[model samples]
Target chain A: MEMDSGERFIVPPVNVRETADQIIVEAEMPGIDKNRLEIMLKEKDLFILGRRAKEEPSMGDPVWQEIPHYDFRRVFALGDHVNRSSIHASFDNGVLTLRIAKAEEAKPKKIEVAFA
Target chain B: MQLIRRNRNTTPDLGGLERLQRELSDFFDWTTSAYPTPFRTFGLLEGAWSPALDLYEDKDSLRVVVELPGLKKDEFEATVHGDTLVIQGERKSESEQKKENFYRVERIYGQFHRAVTLPTPVDASKVKASYKDGVLEVILPKKEETKPKQIPVTIQSE
Candidate 1:
């Protein structure tokens, strides 16, 4: 389905990887300002909103143009094992890196054998 | 009249208008401008880099702010040709000592050019450009004719 401009939501491309202790989500959001970006987590869902500004040209006169002004937002559903309270996000340059550490119960535990 | 009436969500007939608006918005957001064959193909292959633009219009001029991360002031060039503003720049990836274990890479690199057309004529002579913290701001003073004029009011007893 085509996405409407006023839809206020987008599915940003994301890469999710699970390590021993945390699940990392690297989202590509080039051109977005760190200050203008908003990150939120509620329950098992994460939301991101940001705007990507366009460059203007310094010409004596503008007779024609093409670019348009717009913003983007995305929401993702996190797995049950994710620790919502421990989730951390940071924006560097334009990429948004999210780290969600898994709950203690979610990690595999090594059980020792009892010698009788 | 029919199309307008059909679009009224308040009324059952407004469904068409709602649909049209949704369609138009989708079209605007996803569609790319019609460029020459080479440019059009390049845009398709390299992904459309529309980069969100914010234009704030004031009494004297219009200010445009563009987010351009990883862009250096010297690496990019901006110029106004007629009513169009063109920004061309190259984003080079940082040097890597070894090409080992390189998997998926999606970041855009190489020369990129974006052009924006002003809705109203601007006084190009008063244009100013500044770059800070990876954001590029351009100020374009509107032409005298395009600036909103405040009509003088003569007090008269009615």
Candidate 2:
């Protein structure tokens, strides 16, 4: 989803790992509501978009600011051999986890060696 | 090496100095190690990590917000001592994959301890804290005596 004009965005930190048959991507996006998050797969790219609900006016004026009050956006290039159709995602505790399975061609194959 | 891309120029950006510092750090991090230890694990070795904090003040209260993604409600502790608010917690790694299995690891883990002094005196008994969506918020109500009071000026006619 596209943010409104003049909206700011922060790049959420991510951790990517590969297993024998699948790849895992975890993005940390604190303060974002589940309904405001979107994950899209286009061609060979995986996109994650999220926006935190605007702070309440009663939250008061900022005395010390460290965390950015901006939307979250990050993209990762999916490997060519990943199974885009079989990708799965889950959100919990403000973390978005995506699991993309590797296609058969990408999995390791053991060849039989025979005496000839 | 450029598998990950961040959004730039499409939206309002951070201050130039902050952006430059972040870019420089990212560059050094990408170039320093053969494996590019993103999270470093050095904070874990040092026994403590400090989470980012934001403090806000209004007429009635001081609000403290902490960024602590992936932590369960039970994983952290928050307390107020005198005029200081202290938050201490540990965020364990979610995946137990081997070191080499990671293509990139930028998420921080291990223990974290953060403390911030409240600007004005607060009523300790009315303080409240809650955790939601990986963010921790603590609200401390200002002391009744310290709250601004308007005294009516009386005119004495001679």
Candidate 3:
């Protein structure tokens, strides 16, 4: 059931960080069920979709409201430095975390200095 | 009852055509870089953040729902003082690893406090709260004396 009218997809706030071996992306999506989350990878793009569960009309008469019930959607343009085949996603406590391994060439290569 | 969607924008709703146009433009700009600025939901004051909430009132009780993602049950506190309900919490970063290179940092983290004044007096002793899936819901039952009383309509004949 759709709560709001219009074709608006709430762009969830996300954090992207890079570590030595992988890139991490975390997106906050509350009120979302585990089964409703979808992660897809196509070519060089990764997509995340989360459909919020329908809110039951338990409480009557809303006095003040600001929270939205729209579905969440985001697409990330992955670079060649990321290994798409090893990408992993996990959703816990309403936070979706995606871990993408760095490609071999992207990893930091150490150069040893030769004593002359 | 049909839910009335209150539009915050003063501009008139242009119906489906306007929506289609917006969707077309969004489709063309699929990448996040195309957006000039990332969406920033900051609090009124600096170095603070407040979560969005909803307030609902029924005949028997009032329900308040606050969105506090990435928080554990022990991290927040809620209290009722007089006719005001206060909720305070802190959101710490998830990872303990040393953060160095960040491609994008849009999530806000820090202390937050929200105080809501109730329209009617409630029985604070009976108030209940529950947290699940990053959302906190507080239910406040109305005082017995404040509940609306229905008087019986009687007709008397002399």
Find the candidate with the highest DockQ and give its number: 2
Clashing pairs in 2: none
Residue A57, model 1: Cα distance from true site in angstroms: 20
- Give the per-residue lDDT digits (tens) of candidate 2, residues B36-148: 22333222223245677889999999999888888887789988888778788777765543543877566766666777877889998999998877788999999999999
Worst lDDT window (10 residues) for model 2 chain A?
Answer: A1-10
Q: Write the residue-wise lDDT of candidate 1 on A4-101 in tens digits.
A: 43543333445456666777765656556687788877555577777654553343332322233345566667777878889788876556778889
Show model 3 residue runs off by greater than 4 Å. A1-6, A55-57, A112-116, B1-38, B41-47, B93-97
In candidate 3, which residue pairs get closer than 3 Å at backbone N, Cα or C atoms, i.e. clash?
none
lDDT of each: 0.58, 0.74, 0.75
Better candidate number, 1 or 3, judged by lDDT: 3
- The positional error of residue A113 in candidate 2, measured at the CA in angstroms, is 10
Q: Which ten residues in a row have the lowest lDDT in candidate 1 chain A?
A: A60-69
Give the TM-score of chain A in candidate 1. Answer: 0.71
Candidate 1: where is the Cα deviation over 4 Å?
A1-7, A10-38, A50-72, A79-85, A92-95, A101-116, B1-48, B52-59, B67-75, B81-84, B92-110, B117-126, B130-135, B142-158
Clash totals for all candidate models = 22, 0, 0
lDDT tens digits by residue: candidate 2, A1-116:
43335555677778888888888888889888899898888767677888776664568899889887777887677777899899898888878899999998998888999989
Q: Model 3 chain B, poorest ten-residue lDDT window?
A: B2-11
